[model samples]
Target: MPTAVPVAALDPTDPDAGAVAHYGDPAREQRLLDNAAGLVDRSHRGVLAIPGADRLGWLHSLTTQHLSDLAPMTGSELLVLSPHGHVEHHAVLTDDGDATWLDTGDAPGLLTFLERMRFLMRVEPAEVSADWALLSIVGPQTDEALIALGVGPLLPPDLLAVPDAKFATGSVPPRPTAVYSAAALQFGGWARRMPYGADLLVPRPAVPDVVEAAGVPLAGVWAFEAMRVAARRPRAGFETDHKTLPAEVGWTAPAVHLEKGCYRGQETIARVHHLGRPPRKLALLHLDGIATDELPARHTPVMLEGGERPVGFVGTAVRHYELGMIALAVVKQNLTPDSVLRVGLSTAAMDPEH
Candidate 1:
């Protein structure tokens, strides 16, 4: 069950508090901003620590991100796929100096997968529930806020994972220095080990101020939707599933490590990329309607004019205060921008990225 934390407890001046009230709960939208601009206590996300001398080598073969050449203080987003190339788990990998830390959305599954794949490698995977907190801070000024926090320009335009501080002396260990996979390449977004998970969650005016100084809007889920649509970023669960492959989702965005040798799903991914074709494409849907607090049910059929066999489903919906409601959907590759699409009572303009 998801635990509820008081937003007022975070910080009275946090813009996140305003967003929470505007959307629903201030605590909920806290991490919507990129970097530390909107710090939400995201301890609920699972963090698994990979230890042992072969830690780097073991995970290198397991994940899509190349980790062998990974530099220190850097992180990469990776996906664990089924042998068929379908996404099984989405993760963020960071080398914290002594051990390669794999941050996955699945706490149990990640640990299980690692254990099952250990083979003869001299590495060990352990669950580190006591150590780190996983927070997804998003916002236009996210980088500025991280920089202000003493991290050097973390976040994609950089992908560096420089440490802001050691949360505790002996509380948690670090990843090994040598990189074992290509996924170790940096893209931006530093995953630091904060001492107490709760400190980063608490909203401090100082944190928001750093991003505000960058002159970017402090956004919540609404603004984030616009940004993702503009960037064509895919969200887990909403935009993908166990059956979804990186190729079908237009994962040209570094979500998959194409050059990384076989892991699970490597064969299917290769076949689809080389011989077969992507079945569907992830696209943005601009529908006409006022945004609502109650999200549309997942997998709700997205229809085209005449209610033809529904083209797709709502991947994610965000109420952009200014732009109204916008969503992402996976539709048949045959669908074109000119196609008139609909979902329930609303008509949508299918905007497929070229």
Candidate 2:
């Protein structure tokens, strides 16, 4: 998904490298959420397809979601945790009745694990990202914007649990790789958590067609990330470390099914949830001290204002249209919601709303 648009490379090693930072006015791009839709290039995200009769059952047993009775055309989320309960892989999925499609950013490791665990199952996991790309239209106008593009109506929002049409549905299955206009965008998507938004999965070749006809502002990875942070969503690699548990990031509800039979990391999740507390918790921090255009670097140590040691590590930070400057960080679980912290030169405080 190469773009001819202006590039906003934070650095050569930025995860969002080769992405558009903004289309002229970065502020205007951020404002898309106020009342309009903003387009984001998420093509770099991985896409996996598991097609077979046993796909659902196999997934049900291997992961956190109870997929055995998953319904077709519904979107859900799943987690592959380490045997000790550490979060391993997370993906938002949809069943189109023919094959289950996974839209995730937790890559190579996720694919490797799925491949190795398929010993005798009647399922095949293949990386089809080269042929497919994920493009998202976020904000309140997302529905209308996508509809205008002829991508069709998106599936009612569904994410972590059974499909209730509220952006979460943990149980589901898939279908042919055809149209996504009305039936889950034809390519399939687990609706976005940012305000009101939708993900558009399209063929790699048709990206230009869709972008050109988007009829909305084209935002860079920066804007999209800002929105995600405001949404309190945790991305895998960024918000997680090797020791991260599903509950540590407020992910269990949307990514784990507590009543499910069994999976690799079930015990850790159960023990922590029922018996104790996670050592850390995900926190959204408002960095009022930061430059309006700057964000703290990834993994930057965050400190309590007068404390000597680092209390947590901040993930990616971004400037939001309304939220100002913010970032997600993993910190001591007992840290109070109103605790004031510091990120470099920025004075930070936990967001009370999230």
Candidate 3:
């Protein structure tokens, strides 16, 4: 098989590969978490460009997330799933009015996979991360900072601003420079990028800190794991594969379009959603009494108490400070939330909502 390389060498076949991020130093995990709660630079994530006459219609027929509703300075969660309903990728689309750009995990070869699938469609998929910068503004105070940055005036009102853009411009020490207009879903950080060929300049590191405060929550791989699981979000590699469908990974809500007519795997997706139930369901596993250092690694089978047959496998695990040890798992649909299962020495219950 031809190997694929992005930021790090990856095995697309492995379910846990995307979680093994190779950003900066390992200690930056806290920084990432802080950035989630504050402001920070994270341009390593990949960007995909979708163009072509049928680009909008083509993508609308493929993934979840409403495409027709997308407008400038706004975005939504986009998910691509397998025919059986397993998650292929979880992406966020930021529409700048020209093309729909996808922001997603820096998985190896993902860009190639996207481009290769763009055959006869009007949609064009290409990587533009190298040509632009990406950053995130998270945390409770994100809206406050957005107002100070003056992003409100710069963005269009058809969507939203973070109440207003936050900035403190001037020669003074607290001169604000960073800003992004907000519109929905509890206004947070902004992901900025110039056109692929444009010479957009990113401010110096010191500048972002001076404006947004350098206390960005730098979430490492583990922090991301925790946040994702808490959000009940299905993972790509772990919860799904080429044989998996979106519904199987708890992504049946908005990714697949039943009435949009056929695409590559539309037949299978429709049949499964209409006639058959998904084979596997995404679940949250809350470990009982497992210490942060004692969690099991990936591919750990979850064994039902009375039955020797394994019911599912652990997808992602994290020892959240407030939530304790938790993981996302692919379990038999027969399993109900709060059902108990064992994985080695740790015990977990299915999340009620999963």
Candidate 4:
């Protein structure tokens, strides 16, 4: 992943300022993210641009979300599933008037899949990761921070737009095909609510200017991960694996549109939703004894107290400032919320939050 801007432009004393991890005081950065506002360089996230008239319709028939009527300047999320209904890839989707934007952790793989499925569709997909930069402005004052950076007006009207009742109409106005020029600043970029706050997609060359203008402390990936864990948000690789279904990780409502037209994994999703329950369900595990600093690593076995057999495994674990040692785990659906489990060497009780 490339650095958003020059390291010298940021605090030099904070060694990891331009790296993937934290800069200096991770705890202090986490506090700023929770209380005020902080900027995180997410340029590593994959970005793809899909242009042409058939973009929405083509993507609508391939992904789980209903994108055929996706309106201009609005956003939604979708999941690409295997034929048997397991989630293969996930993307955060939004569209300007002329083209659609797909953001994911695996841009190359997504681009390859889309290209292979193009057939005769008018859609043309191109990887634009090098051309754009993604930054997340999180916390209660996220909007204020963006305004201070002079990018507030670029955000869509409803930053928290989802694929639910609010956007049921699915009507989008026609947009002109124009290059992303200075005049396009009002609608050139896209912003959407994240688990921590909201993310802004901007031009790559302007990242340094934006960071300097924001004047807020920069946070590392560790702080972002902790906040995401606290929010109980399951990411693509950590909480989900190859055979993982959407319902297993609690992604059904927002990422899956059951009532929409037929898609690759629609049948399996519908069958599981209407007839049976997923084999596993997501849960929040509260580790016992906060005194110990050691936390269980990912994929550690989660077993029933005094039982010889393992029931589940940990996914994302973090030492949250407020929640202490908390982790998200995928456990057997049969296990009740009151079940006591053992994670690594520590005892854990399942929290009802998940």
Top of the candidates by TM-score:
2
How far is 128's C-alpha from truth in model 2 (Å)?
Answer: 1.2
Q: Write down the TM-score of every candidate.
A: 0.70, 0.85, 0.67, 0.83
lDDT against the true structure, each candidate: 0.56, 0.74, 0.54, 0.75
**Where does model 1 exceed 4 Å of error?**
1-37, 154-230, 275-277, 290-294, 352-354
Ranking by TM-score: 2, 4, 1, 3
Question: For model 1, how does the per-residue alpha-carbon lDDT over 1-354 read when each residue is reduced to its tens digit?
Answer: 123443345556532342322234433343444234444334445677776777766666786666666665555567788877888887666665566676655768878877888888877788774554444345544445445455534333322232222222332213321122211112222334221111122123234343343343333334444446545677666688668988777653355545557788788876676544578888877777644344455577888788658777877766543445667788887898999887766777876566
Q: Each prediction's Cα RMSD? A: 10.6, 5.3, 11.9, 6.3
For candidate 2, write residues 1-354 as lDDT tens digits.
Answer: 334343434466766665666656566667776568878888888889889999999998898876786767665678898889998888877677888888888657788999999988999899988888888888888877767766545655544332322322333333211112224443333333222476766788878777787677678766777777887788888898899998888786666776566789888877777644779988899888534446788989989989999988997788777777889999988788678788998889988744
Instruction: Quote the lDDT for 324 in model 2.
Output: 78
Q: Which is the better candidate, 1 or 3, if ranked by lDDT?
A: 1
Model 2 ranges with Cα > 4 A deviation: 1-9, 149-152, 158-196, 290-294
TM-score, candidate number 4: 0.83
Task: Give candidate 1's error at residue 153 in angstroms.
Answer: 3.1
Ranking by lDDT: 4, 2, 1, 3
User: What lDDT, from 0 to 1, does candidate 3 have?
Assistant: 0.54
Residue-pair clashes per candidate: 37, 22, 45, 0
